[model samples]
Target: MSVEHIQNSVKDVIAYLNENPQDALSNDPPITAVMEDGLRCRATDEDGNTIVTDMPQAIGGGGSAPSPGWLSRAALATCDATRIALHAAQSGVTLDTLEVTTDSVSDDRGLLGLDKSVRAGPLSLRTRVTIGAAGVDQKILREIVDFAVAHSPVADGCRRETPSKVEVRIA
Candidate 1:
């Protein structure tokens, strides 16, 4: 079947389903980690710490040193890279490999208790895309990368910082 044909059919089917909903959609659970009146915000899990911030790099923290906000940005970058690759594949781009890196800088003094000149984070995510395909050229390759960036959900979510509200419900 043609790509356009499949796309059109998929949308139509989705529209019909929405008109006759079968099940309700819900968000996945979100757990917040907190440190009690501490300078560094910390949370522990069964295995240990927040799994990124600072647990103990040797045992899975930060190796005795962890950069602030690195874990959250790492998660975003990883998700972005995978989503980009998936979109590229769907768009007929045979991606040989993908490497994404994110560097975030904030007011360290203020946010991390350095001096009060630090802020949260304005993460700069840089992705180096390399593609190897028999028939794809430079122009097409550029388009592929653009498409990947455009379609990545994680990239969009991070770039937009889509506002969301968390409601705690107690029953």
Candidate 2:
């Protein structure tokens, strides 16, 4: 199935929220987390296991704070990375190394109800393109990147804010 594209500018997203306020903002499915060795961790919906562990010491929480939202960023970045690799190969562009770094600046206050500038989720993802494609020029690399951005499912998912409501039915 083709991925759905969301056309919501950052301002548009904010405006939509302003106009259509949620009854209550709550994370769905109640994603679980555990702290061990001063790091927060949690498993997935299938085969419960620790996806991330031993977070570095920061954010006042401990070794590190591996929140649910961070997972989103990680997942998206990984997806984009893989897609970039695949697209490069498919487009006949040979590459020796490809790397993408995604980052976001959120207000801790917004997350903790103390700061106003911090918004939920990553504010941005900066992708650095380094290609070692033989017989490929910068323009081709740029085209591949643009195509990857246009078609990357994770990129679209993040932009769409595709949060599943995920109701736990009582059977």
Candidate 3:
């Protein structure tokens, strides 16, 4: 889609929200993941798009699809890149290229039940964004980057901690 179209769509949404604040609330349908084989599973979204997940051979699963942890980091990086593009387009800054890299540290001991103190998930994540645009000043580019980071939902989510709970049911 054209940048102008995207900007107009965003404006429309903003106007709608201003007119009907209570209608801003929305929910996504639950996603489902099913085991396909040894250490392999398939996750389906509400639209029926499916992604396969698997562990490395060292972890006792076939070296097939990417691990969930890798996917999580990838999601964050992609989201950041997309938001940067959107914000740049809104600002009339045509981006020739945009990239985001994410780094995370984790302790496997927690996942393997080898250590009680170690956390099972990534302890921290860092993101780096690079953008290339013709005729754009360095200051403007920095502003675009700052705006993207400040308004990015994924970036906000990474900074805050959310509670998650799991329940098991016998079938």
Report the C-alpha lDDT of model 3 over 135-160, residue by residue, as the tens digit: 99999999999989888888787788
Q: Which residue pairs show collisions in model 2?
A: 55-63, 56-63, 107-118, 109-115
| Candidate-wise lDDT, in order | 0.59, 0.64, 0.88
Give per-model TM-scores: 0.58, 0.62, 0.92
Q: Count backbone overlaps in model 2.
A: 4
Please give, for residues 26-141, the per-residue lDDT of candidate 2 as tens digits: 54453455445544665554345447644445654454446566677777778887777766766656676677777766555676667566675566666565656667888888
Candidate 1 stretches greater than 4 Å from native: 1-26, 34-52, 55-68, 110-118, 123-125, 165-171
Please write out the lDDT profile of model 1 over residues 53-72, one tens digit for every residue.
44445433444435445666
Q: Is candidate 1 or candidate 2 better by TM-score?
A: 2
Error of 1 at 61 (Å): 9.6
What CA root-mean-square deviation does each model show from the true structure? 6.8, 11.3, 1.5
TM-score between model 1 and native: 0.58
lDDT of model number 1? 0.59
Weakest lDDT window of 10 consecutive positions for candidate 2: 1-10
